[model samples]
Target: MLEVYIDGATLGENGKSAASFVAKNKQVCLEGYTFIGEKTNHEAEFHALYFALVTLKHDYSDEILSIRSDSKIVVDTIEKAYTKNPAFLSYYNKIAELITHFPHVFIKWISDKDNKRADTLARTGLQTESTVIQSCS
Candidate 1:
């Protein structure tokens, strides 16, 4: 089984942004990243999931996939408990489309304290354009 946790950060409009994914198996960890430029925080959040899903596409399947995010909008929207504004429907759809490729997935909301690794990577991405967040194993 593979357990993956993802997080994203946005510095400001037109500012640096990044998404980080940490995949853990027992004592091992694998991380991934992408530098997102000039996007909102919400966009960054969704991008984090997108990057993780794409990176794991080759290895993801019926196995349990768990995701954690600080964005209530993304979490609630994905759970179908709330309807997002029509203006952002495209964003929602993009995430939904990516989800179709996963057999079993779980998303949860975690406070900033529990999501430090991702936060660090996000901040790091904002500070350096050439730096790529490393995947920990």
Candidate 2:
């Protein structure tokens, strides 16, 4: 089974957002963090999960997966496979589609303390955005 930890960071509501994930098992370890432009925190959270699933599905399609995130809103929405909010429903729908490629996916809600690595990576994405801007000037 592959254990995936994910996190999303936003500078402010409807502000710059970052998404990150770490996926690992005995055979492999993979991770990614990126600035995803302007989005809400919840949107960023979903993006991280979706980004991770897309990254894993091709290579680890046969493996059972555990998706871990610190956002209750994101985790709850995914677990139910439904959301009343039109904004969130879009993300849930996209994530649900990607899920069909896997054998099984278990989503877990974790504490921010436990998801430090992914959180750090997500914040780094904010710094990366800052760095890119500084270098361009």
lDDT of 2 by residue, 1-137 (tens): 98999998999789999888888888777888888899999999998998888878888899999999999999899888789998888789889999999999999999988999889888998789631111000
Q: How does residue 75 of candidate 2 score in lDDT? A: 87
TM-scores of the candidates are 0.82, 0.91
Q: How many steric overlaps are in each model, in order?
A: 3, 0
- How big is the positional error of residue 95 in model 2, measured in Å on the Cα after superposition? 0.4
User: Per-residue lDDT of 33-120 in model 1, one digit per residue for the tens?
Assistant: 6787877787778777778777777665545678888777777877883465774476667767777777877888888888888777
> Cα deviation of 59 in candidate 2 (Å)?
1.1
RMSD, candidate 1, Å: 2.5
Q: Name the regions of candidate 1 deviating beyond 4 angstroms.
A: 81-83, 130-135
- Evaluate model 2: give its lDDT: 0.85
Best by lDDT: 2
